[model samples]
Target chain A: MRYPVAPPTLADVAERAGVSRQTVSNAINNPDLLRADTLARVQEAIEELGYSPNRAARNLRTRSSHLIGLKFQPAQEGTANAAMDRFVHSLVETAGGAGYHILLFAVGEDEDHLRGYDDLLRATAVDAFIVTDTYLGNPQAAWLRQRRAPFVSFGRPWDDDAADHPWVDVDGAAGVDLATTHLLDRGHQRIAWIGWHKDSRIGEDRRSGWTRAMHGRNLSTTGLASRTEDTVSSGHDAAAVLLDEAQPSAFVCASDTLAMGVLHTLRDRGLTPGHDVSVIGFDDSQVAQVINPGLTSVRQPLEEVAVEIVRALEGLLSTPAVVSPGVLLTPTLAVRETG
Target chain B: MRYPVAPPTLADVAERAGVSRQTVSNAINNPDLLRADTLARVQEAIEELGYSPNRAARNLRTRSSHLIGLKFQPAQEGTANAAMDRFVHSLVETAGGAGYHILLFAVGEDEDHLRGYDDLLRATAVDAFIVTDTYLGNPQAAWLRQRRAPFVSFGRPWDDDAADHPWVDVDGAAGVDLATTHLLDRGHQRIAWIGWHKDSRIGEDRRSGWTRAMHGRNLSTTGLASRTEDTVSSGHDAAAVLLDEAQPSAFVCASDTLAMGVLHTLRDRGLTPGHDVSVIGFDDSQVAQVINPGLTSVRQPLEEVAVEIVRALEGLLSTPAVVSPGVLLTPTLAVRETG
Candidate 1:
């Protein structure tokens, strides 16, 4: 369907009003400078022509647009996560503290399951961008660098090519190490690991930490103990298979969502967590607090991550770093009754 | 902070290059129009000055910027919902389909919440807006009208003054009626209702529908049982209170979150939902599927709502309406084991 075009320009209005372009601009911008009769005539002409002052001209004079842009990749269809909601809230609060606002833009997933960065480059309304869910060879970072757009990623970039971009990411490897080591310290052997999409850098790092911690103690990382997928239902199916082959005393999950599914599977088999089997999860999300017996998970400082993202944006705007870039924030393990 | 702001105007680069302003503009906007030597000189000067084309001026020439603004009321600290995240995803997808982008802006909960609207109005980047979480006497609606910005809301405006503003909202009252009538049809003599904040128009309308349906069958409104609060914890607490006084045969919750909590509370008290007492919930969210027995809930068409919001925005831009503001989409029920 066709949409109505924007109204005529100030030049058109001026030509119709039989006045100079400067006088028309003054009537719209500095109405007090014009006499009452002259102002009325100009206003009538503007109304007739539906003239809207160029926002660029006005902003150049005002210097306060108060708009910030937040760029995000939409979650896979039918995949909902509460942590994303918390992140959005945190970003909004941080932007508001600086008297800036946020506009959200969603980039689509490509054939390779990576986010579309070209979409972000085409949109130029936001003053700065806060990006999340980075992948290896993320084009968004490269494009942001070329455009010199002020931006900060919620997670660290996977490649060294992102040497000039700034980021704030949770220490996924450290969190996994904490969970894996905790189970080992508890005198539990044969621990299994369930993770998210293997392509995600965070997921790969967490898996690496788990493997390292396990191998450090001479444990095996082979067979049915490893499942790579993030969905709760997928976790349940994986747990069923893992439980049938060889039961582990503890299970380390990449996220609380996976933990919930595993917990349900254990319950179905008449097993209780923290007693019959220990379970540890990451991203101490809302589900962790609301679930029964609570969830023993690693709590990433999401609020702190958001705060640091804003700080990084400001830092980039001030200094414009040209060297190695990326920041890794630490995560803490929350020991609840589940583990 | 005294950040180094990059010069974005051609005039600034022209002054630095000691060349005419038109020459500099031509070098950037139309390099072919200038000689190779002059273009090289202008390009060198632009690099030295860190000059980029002013986005505002570019937008003025194109008459359409690729930006769409999405505005929401900032949630209270530590209080966020997964539904809001889904809503954001929907907006992003729908807007992206139309070759436009979204920018997220949040207004705080201060006494004059509308004060933040100035930030959005001053920013001339976005072509349209999508507003959500409307409340009674919304000042943002009024401000958008005064500025004549194109926008659509996720929920209907409470005040008749916003009757002219376009919106796409779930039929809360209809959903409540469906839930209540289903319970009544199932031979449930004692039925209770649980809702979110008392002040919200959506909550009030749902409660009103429940009361009307109950009263039609000579049921007592005050003595039956009701709790007004949004959180899952609140739902759990309300369930305990309701059970302690007089157990209802069925409970109708404001959202799936409350239903999850109610289910947990019932399990704690050695009661089984769908067996001991039936339960129904609103917003057949993702959580509904994971919860045991699956939650029977009112499915608000989130994707449809998103599509319609974009359509309304397009309509607003084409034919600026002065009367009969927005449209409200209906909610449907998804029957699962709980009811």
Candidate 2:
């Protein structure tokens, strides 16, 4: 009838079960290696005494922390990228279901970021890391490999020749290809491409998708290619420039921000979006749906991607030595009102 | 010069310094208590041998993880609450500055959630927790207090009498007042209210601010109130219903999502937002600026609140058994094109 106020310890459970401390630990962590009868006795004792294994001690016993590291970036002011939200949400849900948690830490700029990673590694803070937004000569990739740390990036290694790491990236070229193909199927001859002017693997991959789609069929994309920054204002200016230079019937935008910008330009000229000039956007953001004319966009299978990333990371954690190849998931086109 | 492939250890440092292992440890972790000569000898040995303290060993010695836990919930599909984004961003930035890292975990449902919290606590996975979006009988508050766990909520304790925990909440009422006063100053006599239909401390607090402001000036809010779910569709529906029946000249929405919804309805009816009716929203999200006509909103001082929350929690962590009181922060008005 009387219950203990203090938390039940492993020693208490071991005493109740008449087993050694090592046996108790094995029952909790490596039950398969023990005899069925011994396992049953330890389990019964643990339940009867309401004993929960201490984390620090459990960590020492198993040499594992079921914790992954994620670099949490605060969104820049006045920016809303739903793709980032989707990826993190799906990744968290997937990882959590697998009994893993993410430790979020601020990654300092440049060399400081590598130092942060080193400290986390030295502190035994995480079992592995999920690096996003990777670029050429990314120090994280180099550091993780140098330390032989278990990790699976959510983006491709920019320098493929130099870097060898497990990763998962939604095929940007495939996503834009879907958008361009869909617009072409809608009987649009001149399909323009609107994207950022930056030099990025992702940006280049998306532009190439459009170029390949056009060149493959000889659809005459001349005077229809325009570039701008990732801002709505930039998209608007790019739209204006492209419109002045060429007469394109449709456009494939790199981001929802740019898509919304194109819509802004159309509205300013008192022109109907779909009827005057069809538009397809990448990243099926919530803004794509809320704008005056719904945006037909390419929806990255983020949930599937999350599941894949976790599965890959789990493989690394479980085996530790296997260098799994990279994963690439293709996005699907979401046909809404715009196109 | 040859370097050892294995990392330098405490034994190596102690052997090189010709001092006791405990003296070497004190040099790395706690140098104040050691004699200056002993500390200097150990430091020189460490520098010479390139010794780095092992994290697992350090953890066992200090019994602190320097890890904070945060529950990351993905916004429901089609829902975008930038307040969530702002709060996490500022909180992480502030905590990181203080040498604390956040462990982002997915909260399970009901009993599972409590179990997750308990597991994290037992595992020493996090030093403390920052509980947000608290409600009456929030199991986290109850469970943490019952176990004497260290945690500080980002929302006020809902059950005022029973739950006395350290918390910090933005004055929702004050936010509404800022929005209402701004509208009133724009020569609007009939200022309507749009908010959630649910019974929540936050919802009630926001509505009461408007009521107090109107009542203080002997102005009637009669036929000027509408409520809906915190979504754009609901906001649009509620706006339609209110505009049809209330005939108010201006509206104060509980959230930017709702304000955006109202704008959608107004545009549909061929009504210019500011000309026909002024509108104000809360949270001052990026949506406020991106909309056709910018929205004037009451912005929660999230960065300040983040600092305050961390400051209060840091105080509790540094000195145990001292119950720290809750903190409250004010909101400011951001004027734009809407009002």
Q: Identify the leading candidate in terms of TM-score.
A: 2
Q: Which ranges of candidate 2 are over 4 A from the true structure?
A: A1-51, A108-111, B1-51, B108-111
Q: What are the iRMS values of all candidates?
A: 6.1, 6.3
State the local distance difference test value for candidate 2: 0.77
Model 2 lDDT tens row, B1-339: 111112356898899999999988789879998999989999999877545665555555556677788887765555446666667778877897898887777765554667667777766666688888697667788777666567889888877655556788899998898778877777787898999876766888899999988887789998899877988899889989898998888889998878878888888888888889888888887667565667888899999988988886676577343446777889999888788
lDDT of 1 at A141: 67
Model 2: residue A295 alpha-carbon error in angstroms? 2.6
Model 1 chain B: worst 10 consecutive residues (lDDT sum): B73-82
Error of 2 at A168 (Å): 0.4
Alpha carbon lDDT of each predicted model: 0.71, 0.77
Q: Report the C-alpha lDDT of model 1 over B80-131, residue by residue, as the tens digit.
A: 2356666777877788787676766665556365544544444455666677
DockQ of 1: 0.25
List each candidate's DockQ score: 0.25, 0.28
Candidate that would win on lDDT: 2
Residue B25, candidate 2: C-alpha displacement in angstroms: 9.1
